[model samples]
Target: MSKQVVFHIGGWSSCGFYSKASNVLASLSILFPSRLKVVDHKYGSRDEYRSWLIGTSGSGFRDTFGISKASNQTSSPFAWIESSDGGNSFVGGCDDTLAWCKDFCAPKEEGGEEKAVHVDDGHTKGHGYDYDLVVIGGGSGGMAASKEAAKFGAKVAVLDFVKPSPAGSTWGLGGTCVNVGCIPKKLMHNAALIGEILSSDTEPFGFTAPQALEKGHSWEKMREAVQNHIRGLNFNYRVTLREKEVTYLNKLGKFVDAHTLSLTDKKGKVSQITSSRFIIATGGRPSPLNCEGGELAISSDDIFSLEQNPGKTLCVGASYIALECAGFLAGIGVDTEVAVRSILLRGFDREIADKIGAHMEDHGVKFRKGVVPAKLEKNGEGKIEVTFSDGTKDVYDTVFAAIGRSADTGKLGVENINLKVNERNGKIPTKFEQTSVPNVYAIGDVMEGCPELTPVAIQAGRHLARRLFDGSTTPMDYKNICTTVFTPMEFGTVGYNEEDAKEKFGCGSYEVYHSSFNPLEWSLSEHRGKHPAFAKVIVNKDTDAVLGIHYLGPHAGEVTQGFGVAMKKGVTYNDLLDTVGIHPTSAEVLTDLTVSKSSGKSADAKGC
Candidate 1:
């Protein structure tokens, strides 16, 4: 029996028809026999083509292709090819066309056999998995990956569950940054800044009111406002997932096998899903010190939601979290003290860290350096009595522990699949986010050696999705990432620090150009001598390329972000010098930097 084949070349614009139709027709001829009766229908526009393809144009070939009519001959099958009239003529007749098409469509994986090689949606004609991608942990990374995959027509699902903190603090959909970490921290930091402005800067700025002269900040009001904003963000994330057609479940996922997961919800209801691929982005949580009465001390997770103001607070550890909490506490008129086990910002440059510490000290925040908390005990007056390893003790109304964070990988069932994680820290080790198990991948803070930042995770996640669904091979670049510490004076940095550059390239291999300048906005304030803004540019002595950049001043984050782009482009000190300086701005210090460390000249800035 002869088969009816229809080639409807419709909607091909002038340019597209010439470029694509010849190759497509070549593939079609190779797949079918010459006995087939082939009919070609050409149309100029997409609307006209759609009408004919749907049989509204009264094209008889639509009936042959089984559009509205059925064929009595079960043995004969029909096929359709849609195209447009391009200027190019048909290149070959039947046999030559068949041979060329066969070779072109041959599977590269197998030896010249035509097989479906799916690239976009993870499904290949015949597959057994229920979903194309299943992402565990609906944090920033997981959500990004899920949404990106869905955009390519893949069936994606995300499972997320937030286990409460030790202090019973819990949050919703948008993960740590939105629920507890960055969002709340920045809001509280801004609140403290507002308090400082009202108490100190308002008078200098020529704005003053009787009520604005009050010394205290309303902790209750600030907490409520921040929490309300966080709640709205959480809801928006849910709405986004729904709009993207990515299934979101409030369930905890545990690996049952390479392609299977057992999901358990809050009420103990359990379900299972199987996918061709999986992503783990569970992220991390704050860790408390292991000491007596340590449970009494709260971590950052609980601080933002505190019911009342933390008065006379003692922050333990030298991590950025500790310094930030101490800075804001002091800024808000609270008596804040920091207890450091060793150096501040351990992996950061000592010079910059010391400057930050000195600035904090000048701002009324005290530091008890070189002391580790040996024990903590409650005093009779409901204060925390902390004992140091050096046999000294002090009391404070509240103690905050910001020692470090641990990745949330304990309950992920990595052991079931022999997925290796760091023995010391529960961080999943992966190469390009692919775990030891072929189908399993990891991203975000849970991955070993990955940066514990939100944007880093989001970028990695989106990149991974593109690699899987869009046939992209570019990996996430982790170098020269700019980060900001929201201390009272703020610290923003990109690329390597001075010490790191020296260690990597040998001492005296680089030249450091630095300046101490007063931000124009600070002219009216008392921060001139005590908290002068500083900028440092580290350049390779041999190449003259800018290796690193650091800034300390108001809105340091805003200033450093621009320099970060320049550093990524390998902007050199000469390039910076050639760039025009924006007058009266702290960031322009980079362009105007003149004093080198070797010069031994004073780097302090004078009046404009």
Candidate 2:
């Protein structure tokens, strides 16, 4: 007797109609003859048939039907199906059964499964894009966002490319902080400190090395060591991206549309890719002086990688970058001079800023205050001839410009979208890191009104990724961020300055407690009595809560970090007094502060 098989195209369900399956079965029947075997298996759903075909087998139906055995078997229950016509068939597992059936029934010209339509309610299931998220620029902000989005199972990619400076200075991955800004700058600062210690702090401890002062420092050795450490960080960043399964592309990206980006590599080869979301974190670069022959002046980007020693250098501008460069240069035995446009550290607390400037000046750094460069000319002696606006002139072996930095958003093609960017400065105006475009966002120094520090960018980027993928709604808090300036005497501060605090809480509404003491280490140096370490705490008179804390001394960053946490927790003046003091430490001076500015008392620390 010839066996007959009634096979459903999809799976058969007793309660549901299978009209499409019936049509497909009718067509199959016309193509086959009586030799076909038909069996009526009442599989309730597609999952049931899939389980029977591929799952562990002990089914009596396999024995009753006496169907041909599978040609191959292994650890998996599913194996190749053998056909009598010398053809082989393969069935997918349960999760792919619906897709397999759709492909089997549809015509080849009609494509496979139908495209899924998604409703845009701020999120779409299975949204169609080349990637779930694409971040432009491999800086601190972009890298943080990429890694964070990947944690939520997002298909993330980051494209970063560094444009060489006019001085031909270019670095690898990890952006400004690792390459040219914080990492290298701090290393150089430490080098200067070591030089100071060797020159002055060795005698009083009874270890007499009189030749140490004359032996001096090696600029080449310091440069090589700092650069080597920076290069290692670049390699580690690449390794981290791979470990996190984030795709990294070394290509410059420009916006083609809201969802598309045009990428260009070093070879000038161009391509395009699309993503459901994009983040801009290109950061910033040092700006050039707006004067003739200004290109001859190197900015902060080239300072750390200079070939030879920067002898008799002249640093222009009164920004932190200017003071930092000059301070290190002077400490390392180079003749350094700074030309200030106006005030030092423009946005910082003026009192602490002047003290830092005074400390540098006392340590052999010259200041040309209230002067701006008019023209820069290369003299016959191959020195930079800097002509001031007031008809004065000076020449130096190297001229360094630290006027300011401009946001790196020029090549981003942000104008192609509806995003609002500052036309003057190229900074994107963002509300909680979200730009005007719904699918695009900006973070880090590239966003207006955001702190230009690396930690700020890192936190903002991670928070943004969590919100986009993990359904989080918490926004980043930008207040009370502790920061340290690596001047000759480091200045660390958090929250409001004394001037701002007084203005905010009325002229006499806040109590300012301050003390000045000499560091213990300084007692062993010849320059002991020249400059004293200072500490100030501002308290709101009404609430007695600490509003601001400032320190200017050795290890200021370490000392202020602890107080920063206290200020964030709303620690009061009495609470600080209640805390026990650590013996003979600069930070202990805070616990002993007893003089307030309102009382007309001298705020000075005596013997230990």
Predicted model with the maximum lDDT: 2
CA deviation > 4 Å runs, candidate 2:
1-123, 210-212
Quote the lDDT for 422 in model 1.
89
lDDT of 1 by residue, 1-608 (tens): 33334343323334354225544554466665462223444466555554544456455444444434322211111223322332222223234333444443322222222322223334453468988899988888889999999998889999999998887988899788887788888888887777777767777878774484464577888889988998898899999999999999999999888778999999999999989889998998888778888888899888988889988899998988899989888888789999988899987767889999998898889999898788999989999899988999989888999999998888988888888888788898877778777678888999998988898999999988987788777777777889999988899999889888988779988999999888887778885467687889988885577888999888988998999898766687888999998987888898988899899999998877
Q: Name every residue pair that clashes in candidate 1.
A: 8-81, 8-82, 9-83
Q: Candidate 1: where is the Cα deviation over 4 Å?
A: 1-125
Point out the worst 10-residue segment of candidate 2 by lDDT.
Answer: 109-118
Per-model lDDT: 0.78, 0.80
Output the lDDT of residue 320, model 2.
83
lDDT computed for candidate 1? 0.78
> Top model by TM-score, which number?
2
Per-residue lDDT of candidate 2, residues 175-280 (tens digit): 8998999899888888889888877787778877677566777888889998999999999999999999999999999999999999999999999999999999
For model 2 the TM-score comes to 0.79
